[model samples]
Target: MVTVKMLKPYYIKADNDFIRVILAYQYFSVLIDEQVYQFVPTEAKEIRINRRTQKVENMGVRFAFQKGKDIAYLTMSELISLPDFLLQLDTIAQPYYFQEKTNQKNETAIIIRELEQLNLRRLIDKSLDERDADTFHSLTKML
Candidate 1:
């Protein structure tokens, strides 16, 4: 039987589309039949998770564990059965999602403010060209 002993990511990277969990050397350990094994990335590969579906991408990521003179790879099925690992990953990814939402809101607010200013400038220009002192004065007061 396989059981997860510890699964702590070194750092997490998040964007609008995906969240990546990066593991440092010897950071992730598991137990197979009461024997402990530390899984290491074959390359600088990270576990990619889709933000929308909250599932592992599992396309190009590879992890290997040394078993004496032989090396074995951790399979996708083993990863999927670990509910605690998934929960921890989600907890770490949640803050990034919140920050992304906050940033998007700030960007939207800035755009709205800029559009409002442009509209006001156009109105002021039109009022000045039409020789309407009352309209121009009202628009200038908005500044």
Candidate 2:
């Protein structure tokens, strides 16, 4: 069995509530109001701040996350609440940088190997089509 390592936990305030985020390799979990929501990296597509009400007395701020087919929103009554909410969102997005870098390297290696195989196959086909016994024998030996 293989053991999986977990990333450090981070906490931030959303209005009167404090949310905790736990990161892992391909996914992350968020705890809000004693409830935990597990989210996949790809599922979280957007994060933004929304303003509600134009009147100065009734203005409110809403921080939201667009996750796959659903949206999770949290509202704040004070403008000072924006910073912490933004910070938490930034923390949630951090692990994807390392994960994407590793994924890109693996994808590039796979593409290169596939291209090499295609070139070899083409060379073998050409040799057979021309009835070149010496070239065909050499190419087959390389395989």
Give, for candidate 1, the lowest lDDT window spanning 10 residues: 93-102
TM-score of each: 0.57, 0.30
Off by over 4 Å in 2: 1-97
In model 1, state the lDDT of residue 71: 65
Tens digit per residue, CA lDDT, model 2, 7-37:
2333322221222243232343334444444
Best TM-score among the predictions, by candidate number: 1
Give a tens-digit lDDT track for model 1, residues 1-143.
76667777888888878888888767777777788777767753577877766668875445676657666676665666677667766776666554666577689999999999999999999999999999999999998
- Cα lDDT computed for each candidate against the true fold: 0.75, 0.45
Compared with the true structure, model 1 gives a TM-score of 0.57
Model 2 residue 75 distance off true place after TM-score fit, in angstroms: 53
